[model samples]
Target: MLLSVFSCNSEPSIQDQMVDNPGDDGQNENPDEGEELSYKEKAFATYEMIQQLYKKGDLYKENFPEQNGDREYSYLWPYVGMLTAGNVLYELGYDREILDKQFTGLEEYYDNRDYLPTYQAYPVSGGATDHYYDDSAIVAMELINAYELTNESFYLERAKTVTDFIMSGEDSRMGGGLYWFEGQSDNCTNGPNCMKAANTSAYAAYVTSKMYQLTNNEAYLTFAKRVYEWTYTTLRDPSDNLYWNDINIGSEQINTTKWTYNAAMMIMSAVNLYEISDDQEYLDEAVTTARSAHSKFTKVTNGRIFYPPNDSWFNVELLTAYIQLSQYDSKTKDYVEVFKDNMDYAWENARNNEGQFYEDWSGNNEGRFYWLLHQAALVEAFGRIAIYENQ
Candidate 1:
């Protein structure tokens, strides 16, 4: 079973652990001082940093420079980055032991409470946390990637389980979109009530479409197109072709906040649909959205391109979309290069003494504490960029 993974450690303590070859400041060594590291090298360095700081046994903690003695494991959202990074590392030909260990770590977050077992936001050891559909969808998508790479039935079975739960959130209230959270209120159709978010809806489409590709199941593709059409029609902004955050189902007012990942997920949905259906229109839609997203979110800094500021993981999602789109549209190659330059610059400038990445990729602001998700984001980005460059 997915739940039978790793045993919890007896109270994690930073003082109790030992790291090899530490610097004077008790951090891992960077590549000399001024020497620029390759994308793979940078990825490896950051992965080591993650292990040194965030890891408690096979599972990862929520933050680095441990805040409390509680040693809280990372929430399902942030741990998605780690799962993504592990998949990327598997692509880069990392050891099977390393990849399997990360998979074992993820089993810690699996929750099998009701009929459809899914990964909860926080581990069961930390008490009950809300199960977000988007979180489980993202993890399932990564598991799909793992299945594609390794041909593992375990990965596929777990992915199908989480995706089954994700599909359970879909309804006809907002014209067939998945709710952001698992359970809905009594009158979700009235007043200022629950939201049907682009992230949840579009990712549900992306996951189901990929599942169709893997299994050749018509049911997956049917749900994929249903949710994709709903999200595209409901949340998309006609003005810029970028996506809004979500639609408040009760008030029927759209949240106009444009997040990088929201648009990226839609792009992914289009790409998956095109690949599955062999439809030129879906390909065109993906290309158009990729162009708009690159223009909307990226900016030129100094001599190179920089990704969107803050929410580093959002940019990582965008990068993933660009890498996938680059196969069809050569223009997205330039978009991927922009992310490459930005990650390289961040490695040189935005890192703390302990080699932890600050949320700011521009290197202008100094962050006192680094987030585990931010570091995991960069590790995934670097590994992904390295794979793209090699291709």
Candidate 2:
């Protein structure tokens, strides 16, 4: 895995190895400078891309034509993508029509859940052939967001059902942490089983916290705290802000070296926890992690913040972390500036002159769905940053 290969050896502290050139030398350069648009500008560009990609009545395609066989559809990817995108639109002062359509489509899918096949992809082909924890978690978040925006009890009930499905696992490695799929054999050895993915766990925690906020239910809060503890104790790297991608179920050592998205999830979880608890520890951890990630994976080089390893998706994840951390700690100008620089670099380099974006700087096409999803996530991050700045 990329994490294992990249983070094999321990490195210097992020403070000591901080990236030079956060902006022009000595001078405070505006984060939104030439060759890169501001966060709001980039968000508007992404919105235009979404408008161009989907037809008025057509369902969102999970992957582009190059990947996933021309135009394959996914039961959950489009819904999740639209959820993120719709949140961005709402922040941008767009009408509710777009969100309404996205939610209506999602509701139809959940209402007719039987038609969706289980484990349609490889690597995770064994499970219960029904709902998986990861998919259900995403569905739960989308439904909760729907309820938050619409004040609908139906959306709340649906979110609860999805959360309950995810919380129902019993296998040793599977129960404490959410599983990738239901009915996965006890003996199955896969990446998902080997690694307790921070993204899935964090999303589960985030949704649980939100549910608690809406209903004042202690159960949701308790579940969020439990997941947060598991994540912090098992997956986090205390010496540095970076997090391990996964953990060995039995040994409980860091399994996957580290990944950008995992760090992003950790930051988001910390933010959510801080909001609920008013605990400075969570906020401090979020700032530390974001700084560490920014110093190591992303650096300001040649007047731009770029991922040295050249995975553009990391840019998006790091941007999300920076925006989330900045909301609580406005003093983190360096981190926020790096985030804006990286976002600008990504928009400038990733997009073709004609406006299409490659999956990443590496130009791999196998994971277009992952790329698109992260793109939408970055857009949402920008919108959130806008809201924070205004507040």
Candidate 3:
């Protein structure tokens, strides 16, 4: 059993909690005018580097014997990094075989017998039992994207199965929202860290909404609508009107703060709801939240970065949502440039000499390696921006 701590698209970005981007990542102050890499070039380069992290064999680490060195000491969310790249490739229609290989490797994260994804999986042991809901929700979301891109039943079916896993995490315990952990039984605890989190519920709302659109299942639609409603009612901070990170199950108190991914998930869910129902309210909600998230992060350090997650990995969801919102509504256009500027900062400053985004875009590069999700998130962000520009 390989154990490690790393932040991800939806997780705490590993050992560090989502916080300020810190000091100064100089790129914002000195936006590079003569950058060598274009968005497309950065996307391709980062995309390829993330794929290289996938090795076929395992090894051992003396420090962490419990952890699988065989995985090259990598984690699960990085696999989602690969999926993000695959989804981008699929949307751009440039890669089929690579995406397929990504899907197969991603499947390694699933407990085939259980038909659901593990929180973190390795080459031999496969994955975990009690899982984080947000992690599985991301897998489901990517599968649906893959399914749409390829019209593959297997992707859709897997998406639905993972949806089942997400749904199982929901309960009325926290005044109605999905719990952060699922698959707890036989003395198991899925959410030992935090019982319910805003991030999990938000993504839960997103994947369910997308599944509703894909299968035309009213049950999914109802669940999607209900989950979205539940999250808003339960997690929305009444004072500032921005979202908080989670509810403290011990006290049943809302953790009165925000994270970029939380807002991103809500943005995507609301936009999707608008797509299916043509409801102006959903669109409006999405725009409002998008603007709020942008405001929270942009005002931080001179509009330099729109996400302050200690690890910029989670910024992927927020950036994609911002781009999607901009595509869907003109009111969100201004935020698009903010995201572009941030990406520019990342490309100019965060990427190492080897050309992969490390942890945080604060211009202080810590060469720890093993940040596949970190790099791929930026790749997906750039790829989506490129696609948006072409249109």
Candidate 4:
């Protein structure tokens, strides 16, 4: 039986959160001036830049020029993205001290609300923030990856704890899919307004499947299959073979807008189910989604393959799914190579003066404020490719 780490309630020191980058001038630099850095080195450089610019103690700021002065710390989503990159680099033998330091920062958001412990979207320092099921699910997935790479029981235990929180979001609503937000009284009662998003429920299924892989727990496997089926049946768009954004359980209205991460989670969840169940149908579904997502989300810009502008973190998730399925489908390898080329192009063209990435990967748009997750996404992308090339 695994126990969760006790939650800390003490206020963080003001002095600790006030650490800002002193030398940052916030100007664009010549891309050619950089010495030829490997993908791994570039990843390291980007990760270090995140620490320098965004690290307010252990947590990060939401934006480069923060939207709000008082609320300086980032929400759970960006922090999760930063940790996602850290875990990726850690797998490639990055600095253990730095990796552990960044990961430990998760404690800031750890909330034990009435003994139903899980992470909230905002740091606990600001009081109890909204607990999004998707945020906790992603955090658990990252922790699971950390545990797999290091064989650390602590990461695994924390992942299980978060998984418990994720499972709490699942109710009989929508014929059985997890609600997007926790503690919402209208989650089940509010017709047409209750959102059980693909991002939340699909990712929860992926995390559950991974937990099953780590523990061989039949209960986890049962939950994974059920949730995966619910998400697929509820959110997938038949025309494109990709997933829709979410569904309104009350009205049964599906949001047809497509996002890269939505389909990517379905692909990954399908792959996990296929491996665990040895089902050809699951593998076939994974392959079909992989091809469809690759064609839909990416395009050729100036002879380089590029992701859609903005949402770097979403593309990172999509790229991860592609890599996971590449073992069975050789075409996925080609998909990743194109993304690698795009990263190289962004390195040369899309960087700002502070070495942070712009929302636009096409190098056409340069902005004043760089997002924390955008920068973190680059590190994750490069680190993944470096790991893949080595393998």
Using TM-score, give the best candidate's number.
Answer: 4
Q: What is the model-wide C-alpha lDDT for candidate 3?
A: 0.65
Candidate 3, position 271, lDDT:
91
Candidate 2: tens digits of C-alpha lDDT, residues 200-261: 57667777887888888898888888887777776778788677655545455555466676
Q: Pull out the clashing pairs in model 4.
A: 27-353, 28-353, 192-250
Residue-wise C-alpha lDDT for candidate 1, range 1-391, written one tens digit per residue: 0111112322211112111212123232344468767888778778888888888877887666654443457667677778888888878887777678878878777887867788876677777655678878989988998998899899998888888998988977868787766544224664332767788889999999999988898989999999999988888898888988778777888878788888888888999899877999899888888899988887876666777667788788999999999999999999888887787777777777778875667775544225577788888898988898783
Tell me the TM-score of model 4: 0.89
lDDT of 3 by residue, 85-123 (tens): 877866766668767877776755566554544444333
User: Per-prediction TM-score, please?
Assistant: 0.88, 0.74, 0.82, 0.89
Model 2 CA lDDT for position 36: 49
> Residue 140: error of model 4 in Å?
0.3
Candidate 4: misplaced stretches above 4 Å?
1-34, 68-70, 185-188, 191-193, 367-369
lDDT of 4 by residue, 1-391 (tens): 0001111232222122112223233344544465898888889888888888888987888777554342668778778888877787888887777668768898888987676688887788877766778888989988998888889899999999999888888877777777766655243555433667778788988999999999999989999899999988878888878987767766777777788888889889999999998999999999998888888888777776688875667788888899999998998999888788888888887777677786667776653225677788888899998888883
Each model's C-alpha lDDT? 0.76, 0.56, 0.65, 0.77
**By descending TM-score, how would the candidates be arranged?**
4, 1, 3, 2
* Cα lDDT for residue 139, candidate 4: 90
The model with the greater lDDT, 1 or 4, is: 4
| Candidate 3: clashing residue pairs, number | 12
Clashing pairs in 1: none
